[model samples]
Target: MFDESVSKKIHVPLVLSMFIGLLTILINFFYSVEDIRSEVYSSQSKELRAAYVNGLREKKVIALTNVINLSSNYSIIESLKSQDRNVAIAGLQTLSRKFKEQTIYKNIKVHLHDANLRSFLRTWDVEKYGEELAGFRKTLRDVKKNKKAIATIELGRAGLLVRGIAPIENDGVYLGSVEFMQGFNSIVKNLRKNREYETAFLMKEDYLSVATALSSSPKIKEFVLAVKEKNVDKDFLNSLKGVEIEDTKNFQISDEYFLVSEPIKDFSNVIVGYALIGEKTSMVETVIAKAKSSLLKQVYIIFFIDIIILIYLIIIVRKKIIRPIVDMEKMAQELSL
Candidate 1:
């Protein structure tokens, strides 16, 4: 009977007390875990943004270098001066083929433009020539005006192009400009293959309006345009209903999709679009898995201490209260007899 009394009063309350401690620890640990995850995602986003910038910078350097090489060629310069499209194509046709075989520089478009910004010859589209670019080819005009090599991301009739332009001159007179351009798809898809991150180049409708693109581009948002080779899926695009395309810093598309964005500018330093860099939330989950293991270890330690505390309370109750009550009842009964 006394053992039953001890269990009913002492053991139950002690278990409850132990559980309270455990519950508090679990709550606090979860909050801490959430903080850790936020910090990790923010840090990773910054790193991804840096990687994206470096990729653009590297592409710019290569474009400038190759454009300079093309402009310095006597044959290409002479061909541009003579307006002989055939000779210009023959001079760079082999290099164009080898550029396609590259790991990331495929779809390179070689354009020969006159000083009037008129399309003279295009290696990518040879038959289409004599198109007046005085209206939309701002980068080529910039190279012609500045008389220096230039490279940047620009909107073209073909879509977004990473272009490098160099002035072609003979006898101190500018004949034309030669261009080495790569499409955005080539770069974004390459980033996915190399860095294992999804990316999209979002162009504003206002900016895209100047160039009559050869193909129809999808509308990601009200006025935002996205390339067909986007690594982000339609679900992520659907999530952008009310979100500003430029406000994608630490943006989470879903439970499993997270993205970070940086604004992209053209040759005139105009903000035309955004570059979204993202990875699946599985990346965050991998880091959190380790955190959860540590949290479990802390919980186990606290639970062990709680068990010991519960055992000590049970011993105290039986010795100090139960035994005394039993002896007192026995003495009273004997005296009554």
Candidate 2:
């Protein structure tokens, strides 16, 4: 009788072990599915961010080219090449006014150069915004040297400016430069208003912050300073001299971030600036939270169903297999007694 009771207890555990094995298999399967889903989500998010950055860069380049072509019209150049500074200024003023009224740009300045490429006639609204002629002159030199369109994000005595430099030639002679300014805040604000992402415009090797959508962060300020210092690092800039666009990289400013950087190309295809797009770690955290919530709900539902099936299987096994063995052991024990 004692042996029969021991056998019945052992058989009960055997039946429970089979159910436990099934539960283990189910857990592993769920884990694998979740892992694969996470990988897919990560890959898709990166691709979408990269496409967005590239599209924005292309749009900026197109707008710049159109501005250059508009400024390089024959009549505009001829007016600048004229002897009278007043006439050139008046003509440019009228054009600037018209552009401001029609387009998104707020201000346009005309710089006229002599045959020797020296600044002679320059017209700008120096009252509202201070004179940036010195910097404009440097930009002219860059255009002449590169023989191509030049774009820069500059912080001048005037708050902030995105300047585009295009050469103007009249009758095969390089006359001067046409400097166009679009307010930096306006550009960045408009971008933020349109999208739900963070964006920044970086000038070539200038570590000063040109424009950003971030409200205010001390860390961001430090990053700007570091980048500016890095720009003056001869070795670092030299390494990026001939490179056009940097690959998508994971960058950690204060925390981990998904970063994509693209070169801003001019009409002539020279890399004059860079565009950086960053998705914050907080954004990823939000995504992870949502994923966890969704997965937990799914896992709970599956677990509930598993519990129901396991209970039913246990009852069936106990009655059909375990009970029969118990009855047989009792009969054998009675005969031995």
Candidate 3:
């Protein structure tokens, strides 16, 4: 009876200990995986935001510097002072052509406004746009009053426009301002060339709309526009209130995306729009999957080693303890016989 009781106690405790050890290992492994995933998501989000900020800073520099230089151009000032409209038109055309000669400024639009904030010359169509700068009255007034350069992202009559305005002066007298507009389309085109990532510009009004986007294929722009018109992702609309930089978890559009959003601010540091960048999730998933696989293999190896150790311990107990007790009992019975 004692031997039987000993056997039961040893087997029960040994089996239970093995099971408990396995459970503990499994729990630890799961926690490790979660930690790794969180770290990866955070790292990727920071990388995307940093890239977007650097790109935006470069473009701001280009636009502001370009406007400042054009505002000081002798031709632009001379045309503003000229009494004859024809002379002004000719000088403006010559200045436009001069800018077109440079590769970077070839596709940019230039507009010359008078002292009263009236558009007098434009590279697109001087005749059609030769009216008051209607929608841009606030920015025009600010530039004229401050006598400083200002840049902003705004929804114009044509579409979304990033415009930079600088005061034009010949002899301490504010003649007018030189307005340089870099359209959304042009901006996206340039962005794609520099970074081969999916990009979108979102502007908020009654609802958030995709001002412009470019995906893997050229047709993706149309799809993005439709998504905006339909107000597809309400989550994105809510997230646009603040400057959020993070990876999307199972995006509504698709599961294969990591989204990064940065706020677009005006001269007064007010949020006007958002620059959304989406990258493929495959890169991150593949890394995580590999790590999980490696961890699983290590767990399996540990389990195998544990099983061998358990078996060796059982053999030692039988040889040194259980067998000796059995032999002594047998010898005592034989002596009595």
Number of the top candidate by TM-score? 1
lDDT of 1 by residue, 192-238 (tens): 78877777777777765555672366776644555664445565555
In candidate 1, position 60 carries an lDDT of 89
Residue 189 accuracy (lDDT) in model 2: 44
Error of 1 at 162 (Å): 0.9
Residue-level lDDT tens digits of model 3 in 1-337? 8677776787779878998998899899999899878777777677767776666666667778889988877778887877334555676677667777955566567888888888877767757656877455688889889999977765555445677889998778888998888754444444446654455665444222323332221122112221223222333333333324322332222355666766666555666555666556676677688888998899999999989988898888878988788788879989999
- Quick one: ranking by TM-score, best first? 1, 3, 2
Each model's Cα RMSD: 6.0, 9.1, 7.4
**lDDT, model 2:** 0.53
Worst 10 residues of 2 by lDDT: 217-226
Off by over 4 Å in 3: 1-26, 83-101, 134-136, 190-195, 204-256, 260-274, 290-337
Candidate 1: what lDDT?
0.76
- Model 1 worst lDDT run, 10 consecutive residues: 222-231
Which regions in candidate 2 have their CA more than 4 angstroms from the true location?
A: 1-63, 109-115, 120-123, 126-139, 154-156, 196-286, 327-337
- Judged by TM-score relative to the true structure, which candidate is superior, 2 or 3? 3
Flag regions of model 1 displaced more than 4 Å. 1-31, 101-106, 229-243, 295-337
